[model samples]
Target chain A: MKQNLFSPITESMYYILLSLSEPLHGYGIIKKVEEMSQGRLKLAPGTLYGALTNLENNKLIISVGVDPENIRRKLYKITDSGVDLIQIEIKRLEELLRNGKKVYYD
Target chain B: MISQHKLFFAWNEDKEMDYLQKMARKGYIFHHTNFFNYYFEEKEPESINYAADFKGFDKMPEEEYLQLFEDAGWTMVCRYGAWYYFKNMDMDALLYNDYHSVQNKYKKLLLFLLIVGLPLYYQLFIFLPRMSNEALTGFLFGFRLFVYFIVILHFSATLKIFKLYLKFSKNIHE
Candidate 1:
């Protein structure tokens, strides 16, 4: 996989992928994203749908099945490629934080 | 039984209505009429004879619908030439008209200021410094007052543009 291809993912996209480690339908993903961000970010339906479409198109995520309780619903899960991308993003963010701390404090 | 499916489009006006009709014939139903159009589908009600239902005819193509209207001796005018024109006329037209007016109003206001205001301000700024000693003294003393008028005009123009955006957004939400 191209390492640079993972760099195009935004912070929100990273967190959204993280939230979908387990299967999640639309509202569940929204709730998880909010919880992960501690309510700092709220994803509107339009923005969430747009991100979902892009992620699915990139093969970073896949629709698993409909929620059993709600037949109208859909559930999605992260692909193996998405998990690898997430690991890369975490390492990149750690390096950024380390550099930022050194420059700001020193 | 109801079946829900995802809808996708790339903003093409030509193929939009045919796509909507195809979706509708396959039992899809539009849920919302505003900014984001949402669609779903369900089976016909058992008590209702599907052949006698006028509501199902709502899903028919515009040309066919217009022909039905014409057969009934009503005249129809085609505007926008898309799915939106047939379904939600009052709301869609009001939103479009408001957006158009706001856009036109801002264009005219900006043109007026660019063509007239900037040159007029520049002339006054330059000429006020070159007047007779007495007039020059007076103009220098009143420079703040002149600046104040310019500031007010700038503020008014900014407010008008802001108001237009607010109205445009409000119409979309409604």
Candidate 2:
């Protein structure tokens, strides 16, 4: 299987990609990521905006809709590629934990 | 209302931000900043968080851009195209959480500056020299020099912005 270049996503990118599983506006992603991470990963607006642009450009996410209250608030949702990338990342992390646990118990 | 005006140096956002914060500490709140002038109005002093993001190269819609910052609790003070100014009451609030995105902001500014410089660069070689003639050339020698000076200034800004972009990019992790 050909590996995706973005398989080893950073923790921030992981949360952001995961957050995009549901349709969310820019602010919604920030709020959702913070909530999901239990305030452990707070995204600043500017950073989150940049990442969203990059992710969209890479075809991992798509602008799905706009907010009713604000014309400028575009909502984003992850694509199948993004979901696949995150799945690979999760398995990578799981394997890492398995290896570390094996070593610790030995 | 008396508005303080000053031209800040290119690539020196820290000094510019410091000046704004100092003004805020002394009862002045910044209202607008174009490329060359910063306009401020006096107000009651309080501890405030100030930040700026260069968004001219943004691929997203403008409404989406500002709303994100608003959601993050930053109040937009003023904007001039690419330059966005914001303030927050929280001391820890920042415009960027990651160094990569911070670099992206500067890179966008650099791209805009480069675009601004290109026409000036082209004009320096294309149109300005074409205006020179014997009698007119001698009479407008000083005018030509002044135009050249402005073009050079544009080039300098372009260079400084590129330098800032590289400075931010160097520390950014993949």
Best by DockQ: 2
Q: Write one digit per residue (lDDT tens) for candidate 1, span A16-91.
A: 8999999987667768887988986555332354456568878899989877876445678999999988888888
Where does model 2 sit among the CAPRI classes? medium
Task: Provide the lDDT at B112 for model 2.
Answer: 77
DockQ for all candidate structures vs. native: 0.01, 0.69
Stretches of candidate 2 above 4 Å error? Answer: A6-10, A68-71, A91-106, B127-140
Give the per-residue lDDT of model 1 (tens digit) for B99-157.
43334334444454455566556645675556536653565657746765875766566
Q: What is the TM-score of chain B in candidate 2?
A: 0.85
lDDT by residue for model 2 (A1-106), tens: 3488987765678899998888998888888999999998899988888888889999999988788887678888999999888888888889888999999976
Q: Which digits, one per residue and each the tens of the lDDT, describe model 2 over residues B1-174?
A: 346667776478777877888888888788887767777787898777888778876578777778888988998999877678899989788888877777777777777777777877776788776865752556477767876898877778778777777776787364
Error of 2 at A71 (Å): 4.6
- Model 2: how far residue B139 lies from native, Å: 6.5
